[model samples]
Target: MNSEGDLVHGRWLDAVGRDGVQQAVGLLDALSEAHTIRRLELPVHTMLPVVLRQLLLPVMIDALGLPRTRQEWGERFHRGRFSEDERDRLAHYLGPRYGDRFRLFDPQRPFAQVAGLEALNGETKTAAQLVPSVASGNNVPLFSALSEADELLLMPGEAALWLLHVHCWDTASIKTGAVGDPQAKNGKTTGNPTGPLGQLGVVVPTGETLYETLLLNTPIWADGLEPQDRPQWAWDERPAGLGCMPAAQPVWSERSATGLLDLLTFQARRIRLIACETEQGTRVHRAIVSAGDRLAQTPETEPHTAWQHTAKPKKGQPHRRPRRHTSGRAAWQGLGTLLAMTLPVESDGPYTSLLLRQIADLQRGGVLSGRYRLGVETSGLEYGTQSAVVENAIGDDLPLPLRALLAQDDGLREVLLECVDQADQVARALDGLNNDLRRAAGGDPLPRDKGSRPSARFLHGLDATMRRLLAGLRTVDEDDEELLERAQLAWEQCVQMAADREAESLLAAAPPRAVVGRTVKSGDKEFVYRSGKAVGVFRTRLASILTRVAEERSAKGEEAAAA
Candidate 1:
């Protein structure tokens, strides 16, 4: 970081003895970017965001100062750059000792680690604890083949990548509890909350380059930003335990972020890296993980997450919290929640992350081009019981046309949203079709979740088609009846094919008894439960669900005639 606290990305971490690509792996967020919506990927971890927000963004905002009016924030964003004055302020903060300060092996001051932190534990913890994915200690891997007894060997690069992962998504488990922490019970700590990103479906705005991505993610401060505490690495003196020499671990406390710096690198835990020389290379064989800072009352300020109103809020409790990512659920399935306009329309609504709002502001100001396509990437870890087990790691992306994204009340947004609703309806219809098929075969219908396999398959099969449909929005100027009709036809055909395929597969797998069919008599009425009977009923429902789009169009036409 420069003297003014701006994160100097280039050559900043070269002191770590890695090349650009190697450094990028350690620094950049886990999900990588490409030219277009070519592919989707998982995030390795989150590190750059912490450094940029803590050391750079706060100072940069203050240099730019507060906005004169409501319109100014968007205006500056439209311009999309730092001013000459802002650049000068950053230049003034540079110093010569940055090289030595960034050293990982610095005897007095190491980067993102306390020098003598190993003394607190008096014994080294397993190396596996640094990486969230590693199955060790109490991380009982129900889904993994490796047992907890198997040890892990980490290279310097691997160690660096997962080190950041632990800080951001560390699970709640037994901790050292440190000497000063009041929450420590019997010299051991439990009930420590997971890292800030633990429950959040992390949302990040992607651009062509790092500069563009960083600027796009930065939300202009309403009242000029003020520089508070610098990032821990840039501090004048290193204090291990919240400023006490003897106490080298933070007390178990939760409070609001003091400033951008405090919140970004919130330090969910205090860590010390034990690097040693080995034949292979510098290996991080052992380390210590202890409780650090905790995130409390922060749904509004955290820019990287979506927020939803709790369905059942207690009388005196807050109603909103960071939205969670569903395991095995596609991003396109919940497109409505990612949009900003959906919040005001419903009582228990989910508003989008703050970054999405910033993008909309830029579009409204007429600074952004409609030709540009936006890639909204979402990533998060799904923790199991007590937030200890890493059940699922979710990462997905949606490439939305700028014109469609900026429209809420009318235009392309309505067309896209309407199509999504129809797709969902079709999926549910498929689920019912499968249940009926089973019932006709003389077997009781399965549960909604189990019977919905076909529905899930049908929806997942359309993922590529949906992406193409969204990308195709560029062909239309705005809301066009013909365009929406054409899109609806495409969706209907996809749903029809998927349902028929699943139905045939089920029938082919049936036994001889089921093929013969069954009948039941209830009073005077006789009912048939057979493949033929189920097929007839399914066709009727499918036809009705598919034709609703046309029916709605016809009704709207009649309403226009009445007017």
Candidate 2:
């Protein structure tokens, strides 16, 4: 802060670690320009920890100054001009509000811990209990290397990080009922979400820089707090308030987030850190964790998620809820739900996440240029049976050009999605071909269709071509029919070449038995499963699926011209 006490500044790519500005800046810089971050050598999962993102709205509000109306919001970014004072405020919120520390056991106000849990003599749980990676309660460490870490002792700094992680993502088993919490029945709370972020398939919009990234995620146009559904509540920071978010008392309750400020900084758990003296210094040895305030993340208030809409819902009025990410699915494979103006009937009628839709709005409104490529980052956890285990964490970044996501270009979008559909259909046919050849050889079908490695490989092969077409769509002007033709033709050619290579590999790997063929009962009818016959069948299916998509696109274009 300067002499006037009104300034702060930090970028996502900062080289040095500055206190209160942003943590992990140097680490992020080291891993800069990475197109994907799937597995870390460590056990931690998820992209940005909740603790870092919690201060997002406050910084955006203070420094970036959101325009009240949605239209103005788009225009403001389009004309990225600001006064010096505005820049100062931006600097202020980019980090902590002057003087706030990230310490876990701060004497004045400990980081994220409820004010009086220490005085209340809250029952303490192991420091490991605060870690999501550790197998606490009855959660058996079936897989993840994250499950077997040093759980015995935690330095206060490391303990604070885990403390926040527990509050944000602790599992659903059972929680210790702090002595003062009235909501705890028999000194326990159960069945709450593993954590708020755990429940949400978080969708983040990224740009070349952090400025564009944060603004894209912030939906200035929508009102998150609707009185009818979710009502807003206040948060008190007074030490006497004994609540996770510092209320009159700690209570497990549900409420609506007033805006971005509260939504990001949601008090998901009541946590207290126990500090003990170690030979080195103060180390956190134990903790108390209880259920805290509950805030539902939806397309309306929470922008970073996909939603599924129901028109004639069975119970309440027609509504939408956050859509979960499917494991083993690529972001581009299900791209329609993220960019299409029209929702696929099969996936329900919800629009894309409010963030994406808003981005589309900005694109069409000239807030973003046609060629400005943006990275769409989607992160979600695939949980095991009964939501007890984390099967896998999914993170995929898809680069999409602004022109490809324009809201008004619905016709072009329909064709682009159809192109995606064409590839999907053919890939599945290849999977069938894999099994048919195996069956012909008198071999039992491969588990999970393992024989269809070709199909998976084929899809991976198409990804580069798909990204090119998506980016190349920027060249298609309303009057330039030639550019559009070339783009479509390019994709068709790429798919054919890629499919042929995959088919060649599959056929070459076949044994003599598969070549000779055998008759097998497929469904109800008896069918010959010769390698030659299986290849022909799949090729025929692929041709038909692609032909059908091409014809549909032409027919739609004709219909559009006629209209």
- Per-residue error at 148 for model 1, in Å? 4.6
Q: Which residue pairs show collisions in model 2?
A: 8-91, 63-89, 63-90
> Largest lDDT belongs to which candidate?
1
lDDT of 1 by residue, 1-563 (tens): 22211223322322111122333321211111211112222235344443344334544443345454436755654454555554555444323434344345456655455666643346677677776666677776666555556656666555544555666778887776454556666656777788877868788776544435556666666654434434445444323434422212344356556555556656677677777776765667777777766766674878888888766678976777788778787787777777754454336778887878767667776756666667777777788787876777787777766666575676677767777877788777666666666666777777755534677787888788888887777456664768767776776667667777877876677666765677777899987777766767777776677785446556889999999
Cα RMSDs of all predictions? 6.5, 7.6
Query: What's the true lDDT of residue 412 in model 1?
Result: 73
Tens digits of per-residue lDDT, candidate 2, 1-563, equal: 11111112212222222122333231222123111222122235363434335543444453444566666676555544334565555445333443243334555555566655632344566676766556655555565344434445775435645665665566666677766777777767766766777777777777654445555666664443322211011344222222223532456576545445556666677777777775766666677777777764442666777777775567754467777777767778877777745565555564677778777777777677666767787777766656656567787777765655765455566567778887888787877887887898898666883444666898988988887777667455644556666666667767877887888887888899898988878788997778988988887787677674457567889999999
Instruction: Give the count of colliding residue pairs in each prediction.
Output: 5, 3
Relative to the unseen true structure, what is the C-alpha lDDT of residue 450 in candidate 1, on a scale of 0 to 100? Answer: 57
